[model samples]
Target: MKRVASTLHQGALLGLLCIPVAQAATGDAGSDAGTQASPTLKAVTVTATRREESLQKVPVAVTVLDGETLERDNRNNVSSIVQEIPTLNYRPSASNKDSSLFVRGIGTISTSPGVEPSVATVVDGVVYARPGQSTLDLLDVDRIEVLRGPQGTLFGKNASAGVLNIVTRDIPEQTHGYVDYAHYGGGDENRLRFGIGGRLSDTLKGSLTTSVGRYDGNVENVTNGHEVNGYERKGVRGKLEFQPRDDLKLTLIGDYSDGENDTPSVVVKPSAAVAAGISPVVPGNSNRKISSDYKTYVDDRNQGLSLQADWSLANDFTLTSITAWRGWNNSQYQDNDNLAALPVTAVHDKGTVDYDQLSQEVRLTSPKGQFVEYVLGTYLFHGKSDETYRRLSVTNSVGNTGVADYSATNDSYAVFGESTFNFRSDLRGIFGLRYTLDQIEYDHRRVSTSAVEVNSIRPSYASSGSHTDSGISGRVGLQYDLSDNLTSYITYSRGYKGPAYNVYFNMQATDVQPLDPETSNTWEVGLKSSAWSNRLTANLALFHSKYENYQANFYDVVGTSVVTRLINAGSVTSQGVELDYALQATRQLKLSGSLAYTQARIDQFACPSGAAASCDINGKPLPFTPDWKSFVRADYDIPLDNGLDVELGTDYSWQSKVQYSLDQNPNSEEGAYGIWNASVGLADYSKGWRVALVGKNLADKAYAPVLSTGTSTTRIVPRDDRRYFGVQLHKDF
Candidate 1:
């Protein structure tokens, strides 16, 4: 049955992608009131190569989202933004700290703090050690660049899978400000955002942005009268600049945020509950409801400061320096059992984390337009964090299982350089390399505090360990201009990640040893083209990657209880084809679409210690990765005689069924689903004011993004679990 569903979904994806660009090329008008000339698509600029360049000319796979487009799409944060991007995925967890990012089905799921994320996020000039920090409600962002594949040489700190380069808005030359408000009816969600920027002095400028919002939640908790899955969040971001000379400029950035939200979602499946001797909820219920005795919540706070300096040197060379410090603290309470009435085997968990990091980077770049251009830099980072977890469970009887405390520290140093050789007017060769050394240490201890006896997930133990390692990674590629508006490129890259430790609450004697480092080798071929007199743009990329010592989760079946532990898998492989295109069909109409077909699977499996005979998952597809995904977006506007513009936009995103568990349990699969969002607005360009009505999940689709099954099944129902409507108002001064 599932296979049949998958086949149908695959057809839908292809049907959507293979039909659009051809019709758009005919220059069809969105409005019948006009005989206007066809408009050319605007040229896009990107910093994917750490330098400003035309998007179509860069020899890499990158998707650029500008500020205006983001606002029009109603995407406020990283999670929402990933939904429309090809091969990009986000996983929410019981707590923000456990959430993760993945590109091309390649990412790490462990929350050990001892392993670095395969994909990294860089905001302005600062790199966030934790990807969860990227969720901090970014303020007044100028643009976001998603660079796919290994960017080790230029990005440096273990971006083996991909990089999310975020650039915030710059200070305005003249005083300016804006305000925006939005209200959603279905979830009873409200959002208010405002920003101000201008010149502060003859040689200085400044800007400030703030966002505040709240939601009543969509899910109902039957155990308690109160609604569950709600959130209240607020944040502030500001920046300042000083220009002592025309050749030198310095900028300082600061931001802070605090919020309290419930668990990602702990709704129990009805069939799973009944099978375990409980009531209410089917395996695929569409009620958007949950049953939990204990309330779940996560209180989080984050703040950061960064300083960047740019100085032009002799011979048109430029030097850059960035220094930053960031901190994140959060506490989580979870109703792990996900049952209205406590069963014989139920569990409750509480955890807290305190983390901070400081980093400094200096780089030098050669002048552009030269025969050979190069970027050389050195990066240093130090991160430290401590965690505490406590749990209570019932098995035959109730017992306060244990309290686990753990701390970890990471230090990294690297020097990287990338150079492009312009061999001819239309041909270029790229070469890059990076060398890094990493040192990590951790200490963990667990103890039971119960009168009922020594009861817990794992035996209480104390352990401490440290590891040090070093490696080199680089890339080689070639770019050629096939025509004035067409380009082709091919590249091969090697990615590296340092050794890791399984430093979690359940620290056993056997886990004292560290896991080996993970690495990958990837190859990519791509073509970028623009046609219809530069009114239509199309790009395609094909990539394949093989990874060794893949960091993943394996299970240990001990006395009828399955305990999960982090380990190094033998091998894994991911390959995919990505297609992106945009067409300016008319002066008032624009069309854009993307499609991705990814095949991610385990090539070799490593069984848990002492569980060899029971483990066999070698050819299984990776979790959270769908076989096919695609999206289509359209926007149109009609200008009135009085200078007002009426705008209409719609976007549809779809994905094939996805598995949410590493153990490959069929019960943990989410069926293929599609979300359709639409909006209509009226705006006065001269007055800088606008109003709009937005509809999300217009078809009332129901789906879960995350799922976990133990004594009971728990899953995360996304924010767009049902149809919702919103009103948006904006003004500028």
Candidate 2:
């Protein structure tokens, strides 16, 4: 492989982030490295191992996105950042309720109240129980750490796939704040945000941040005379810090957000029956125009409260505790038929969800540079959710209408610890383990029905069940120092996810069984190097993982209705190679990029005895697991005699073709494509004022992240699916 340099900040995403020319990332080699003659990257901090450490010192494969990168990306939700990540992908739906995440081709695709996500999302040490919670717009984010591979020992939840760890900025010690505003063309987007923080006394401080934003969608809606797939959102976040004693510190954080999203999939490849009545509203299918009888909308609210305390014990060890509560509510209405006017009376489709969770974690950490440094902790969690889904039959003239209401609860307990042994100064060994117990239960009932629904609806029937499971997950690894600034390591880990129940509205007799726990074992080897006096940095890793009883969704036809049921696949495997590189090419320029090659596939379907002929899907690529993916970026800086500086940057991201259907449906495949973005900014650091003009998809490339052929050949349109321009203004006080 050819060796190249890349900055440590991969967060700029397909070019959403900026890797400064004169700056690298992680710890500073020396003050001289920052000189104009030989500029070096500065220190970047992270807590991937449950402790504050330099990014380069961490053993895990991690991607860091700094605060500045997010500001420039101007993409608010979590999905915006996944676009260009090496081996990371997301599952898109019409609403957050069906959103999911994938890593190395492993992810969950079910919305059952009893099914937990494979990829876990953590915000300041608090896990978001549902995948949708992580989709909310971020506020005052300090950084985001995307950890590839399993993180089961320390996190000790359903983090069998990977983890997206988000860290919010801390309260400022001095009285200061910032204001940001942006206006965009094409979609008529306008956004404004304000943040202020200060110290009230020697022992107390607080900060507040508020934001509001709205945009017209890129997709045209002819029936409603309003653009669909648009966004309207408002949110606020607050934080308080108190240090009554030198040994103790307490922090309280609260946040709330409300959003309205108009999302309705459009038929990219219309079926024979649905294409005859359509007329051209937009030029072509790629123009992203749709016609629906009833306006489709998804409204949601999310709020949370957390209290964290850190105490420095007299014995030199640190003790910490975090208590948190979070809640999310969502309601949605969609045009199920997805046609302007069809004989199907499927317009009365709706869904509602109310979910809440409470959790507590207490941990103790030993001081560094000891014979045995370790972190020990205990975790407890409780969650409850209620859902109601009502839909009119697509074949209303020949089908029926009904409502399904269900509720579920999940409880977990675990004890976990990790230790690093310094066998020698240059060589170390790390081992960790976690013991977890999970309990899940659900109650579902079908109450109302019209048109004398068929046997699939199961009206007037109620059922309830519970399940319990336990497992041990852990990791073992070794690190060897080859040189002063280079290290090599190999690790083996076992990860696990809890069992699940299919608790959807259409309660059938065969759907009452609980799924088995999902498990994976992985082996990875990597090299971390920052050579040539800290001007060049490169990290490389190769990993292979085997998963058993992988949870997935399977469609079964019954009486003119396609029911989506949860099941376990026999076996699967994911093996990949990843590279992150950055280099300070010159004092005025920098070059950076990341690349990955992945082969994720199904080894066996574990088909049934008789009709197993259809299960010959062995060797098929997993959904969203592209074989090749890469991102490249360049940045340049110039200084003028007027005490001002200018920054220019550009980036491009591309990936090979991948199937979006688990069943290997050809209509759900998206071919290879790439996107380009550019930005120009002028800044005056002394006065803390800046202005920038940003353009995304400059080539006007058209692509979709998700597609479905079950009902119709439909595609979900995303923001930035087309060319758009925005200008941003910022001021600091």
Tens digits of per-residue lDDT, candidate 1, 495-552, equal 8888888888766766788988889999999888776656678788899999999987
Residue 302 miss distance in model 2 (angstroms): 0.4
TM-scores, one per candidate? 0.93, 0.93
| Candidates' RMSD to native | 3.9, 4.5
After superposing all C-alphas onto the true structure, candidate 1 shows an RMSD in angstroms of 3.9
